[model samples]
Target: MNTLMVMGYGNSIAMSQILVVVVEILLLVKIGEPLECKRKEIVTNTPVISSNCYRECEYPSKPTVCEYEFNVVLHQTMSAHCGDCPFKKEDCNLEKCVPVDGSSRPLIAVNGSLPGPSIVVCEGDTIRVKVTNNLQSGAGVTMHWHGIHQTNTNWMDGVPRATQCAVARGSSFVYEFIAEPAGTHWWHSHAGYQRASGAFGPLIVRKSRKTEFNSNTYDFDLPEHTMTLTDWADMTSLDIALKVNIPALNPRSQTVTILMNGKGERIEFFDETGQIFKTPRQMFEVEAGKKYKIRLIGAFIAACMTSFHIEKHSMTIISTEGGEIIPYETDYLTIAQGERYDFVLHANAVPSAYCIYASGYGNSSCPSNATFILKYKSSPLNNPTCASYAVVPASQDRDQYMGNRSKGMFSAIDFVSSDPGDQELYRVDLRHYITLRSYAIYKHPKDPGYLNGFLAVDNVIYTPPLLPFVTNEPDDSDICQSTLNKTFYYTCGMKQCVCTNILKIKLGKVVEIVFLNTDEDIIQHPMHMHGGSFRLLGLGSFHTKKMTLDNVIQLDKEGGLLRNSPVKAALKDTVMVPSNGYAILRMKAENPGYWFFHCHTMNHGERGMVIVLQFGEPSEMPKPPLDFPRCEGWEPK
Candidate 1:
């Protein structure tokens, strides 16, 4: 990347050389989103509106200063419009950053966007992103193109230990891959709590060619209609980890705010002089009666399951994790971390203001602070007359969505016939059953002190890291046989282990995995798998009266006959393993790579719940980037 940039910028070249340089420059500028390590906005001891704010401000950037009331409409007036693009190679520059959070605390940022820059690319375009780690000391940074299913490029999977090592601080590496299976997706840090700092963004893949899912779907498919709903902890993930490093600090229970496209009321700026500074809110405007393709990317860090709804509007589900699904209508939807849903909203209500909301789903009480406004140009901005909607429990909503009858719908099973969107469907070649049992491995086996709650739980536990997990190295061992010999490593870490158990699958084989969550207390584990989109075969309580691995596998073996199993499953890249329950996911192991499968809830992943899916002969896989960064010892020490 440096060579290309230097060569492109050099002078003293002939006319032909100059033309080549100009073409290269345009290509680089077209592909890469140049991110600055520092904010374009100037800073001061006192909170001040950035001088460049008016460049996007609706009122003026000139002598006449407009009051803050004009701020609400600025986002609409200033959003960058991505009109069109020819499918071609592209470049992106992502700088690791430490910026202030909504509450004005130091946080991580990428290219300055609180939630990072939303990447727009057409299906089939190959992209190369140069990521520079500019973060403060202690932590390294690496960005995972979540749900991109990098095909044969496993080295770019972005798991520090599983694929390539973390791109160390001050160093830069180029992440190049093909963007396939067009739909709503995202990118985030694969290391530490850095993701919580603002290192997250949407990865939207447009269809390769216009078809039903594209042209005939809705009236509007503008970039502005999409949003990345993110959760921000009042404290950084690193800070929380530090607190947990002490004897016994309770894990962060939830995020302080749920930001829509990285803006919310909870995110406020204040002057050093103690006066409150107004923060902009994300507002979506619509004509009174038109259908809009509203892509919702669930980019979360702390929260697991989130319930999203737009008051008085019905959202029809179109796709999940980048695969088109039969449109299903619902008032509210519950999604887990690393999940993406592209739905269509019918703005049929009267011209007025309505709130688009999303909140962490756990206890019946909902933290409804993360909200955005939906209004029409004809509606009154002040004293919006829309009434508040009641907060509903996710379990109730989850059951409703799961129990939804697939009769006469374009569900996954119904993909038997030819559909352009149904490009990648794997036959069930080899089925494997796995269960994730989350345990709070405390520093002490038996507690010597008493506390109000389970605050003594140390680091969230995971299986130990498979030492020396080199990116190019492939595990050709028989994983199934090793499991029987008790040679598979799972409990190596007992507490805070990074050991990864690699599940090897033959290329072109269809695989089904059943994940059962056994934590009695923490039931919702947002499981996200890389490299492939799996079908949500089924989700229910344990097959037997008790939750056992044997019973779960036995039940999964009979999935074809189980009454609860869907005849046609829905394709999803992420799903919340129900509390005390299990979910069966099926996908084809056609993409050869070392892909990590883990709980999207970062806490559980940090502990040891992660494992790798190794497919095909590694010799057939692409080599690691020539400039791929390496940790001190990627192989086991």
Candidate 2:
């Protein structure tokens, strides 16, 4: 028999008797167990103060108090390079700067710097930013913290004309508030286009808690860098305005030099001596297996699609203005104006030093500035040749991963001409025409004592008309037309024109908006809506032509276009309208509230290229809340 045997620590049993012997041995071992092996009952301790009954204090002032201090001053100095231009000169052109006080003379900049100090803080921290205006002119200024959910802190919203009065020149205003929501943001002057003249800076909010995916650590371990893109015009802003308003003058064709950070090393026009300005180029050193994070901020007047690449390293887009996305790995990423992106690069085995390149999208005249560099550690492997480095294409279509299909189409208008046989498909509930005008500094009769020109919609200076739809009687039409044209002199104001205020549409009803850019100014204006996005139905030139869906569509010399594009996804916020053209935006007013509609150009918005949306039950109310401050005697007592 195949005998089975059971063996214990020091004893063995044969097959037939193994089962009986094993049971007996186990029983003896169990009975001989020590007392320490016995189970014991556990009792939980209770707290004296009950956690279940705890409640948060309803009072606002009971929390721990915190304070922060900051200061602002103006100094006089000069830099040869203006933005990303390669030309360096020894001229301090103060006239080109926006006056701190609404005056004729320009103020010397703070620290003699364009784009002032960056305000950095962590969430829940109270920040006190002090501004002391030392310009010769007594100007009023205000700062708006963009995208920083002001909520009830409307006092700090910083609309100079809409909120509180501008901080007087030679005076100071203490902006005290708690920073909320950690992310990338900016602050700019709300008192006219002072921001355009170098009154802006980064407003960073650091995370309060320890995050699993720490961007700061990622930034510290690898090469870290930043780039701020801005557009600069050669002429004083005032002159640019005058040219834009006067059709005959047609001054909008001016070339804009895009600045990277504070560097001027891209465009050839500024490099008179042809000597490369190497100071602006950025460089970094990295170990073969290290990682890097690059922060890009588009603060310019135009929208840009950027491409970034290092020879062999793959890029991962970690975050956008909307916060972190499901970290996507890509060769390159596209970013638009008023947007920020954080990308990570794992430089594993790149072999040799690789040049990181950043370029703009479309056929932009603006060239890319080498704002930073990435250096690799020495390795025994053969050095990688420059030819072996993967080059990132500037165009989205050319990118093998991005593909060539257009993201969206363009449309200008959606209306059938009034012909009796035509289907009365839709009635015009709100029919109005708006004409934007820019004027020269000296063109204004009032001489607000500034170089900048005045802006108006429909020949009405500083007055946007109300909507719903009204037509003037023939007899009254002639007189009204005459007053409008002669009142501004900027445009022979034509009467029987549409109003600017109160664009009324049926609740939840689909409506089309026809945007006409009559200003001979050739500068493209990206018209963005705050609450919703629309589809481009059609485009029209001197000869009307049907176009495709495009969120940012350029308008041509003569405005005409059809709306036959398919319905696209509904998005919220911003659309661009090209110069000398028209854009037709279609939207269904679903969420009702007051929304801001304006041009994305920083200067244009300050010059009155903005209006409000009033959505709700219809009313015969004469005017909406023209929330202008009482300073200029425009507000009612």
> What C-alpha lDDT values do all the predictions have?
0.58, 0.45
- Which 10 consecutive positions of candidate 2 have the poorest summed lDDT? 466-475
TM-score for model 1?
Answer: 0.73
Give the residue spans of candidate 1 off by over 4 A.
1-102, 242-255, 267-278, 363-366, 382-390, 393-427, 443-498, 519-521, 542-545, 554-567, 625-637
How does model 2 score by TM-score? 0.53
lDDT of 2 by residue, 1-637 (tens): 8964466654543554767888996886577433223332324332121111112222221221122222234332222223332232312224223211111223235445555655555554455565666655556777766545443343455655434467776766666555554455666675665665556666665453244233543533211355565655554445555554443323355454445554333233324676543223334556666666656565665333344555556666555442443345655444444555555667675456565555554444443433234566574433223342223343433222222224221111221211112122133344334455555546554445444554444443432322111111112222223223434333334422222323444456666666665456544455655433444444333212334213223432243344543242112134444445555556665545434456656656656566545444333212222452334435678
State which candidate has the highest TM-score. 1
Top-lDDT candidate index: 1
Find the 10 residues in a row with the least total lDDT in model 1. Answer: 69-78
Cα TM-score per model: 0.73, 0.53
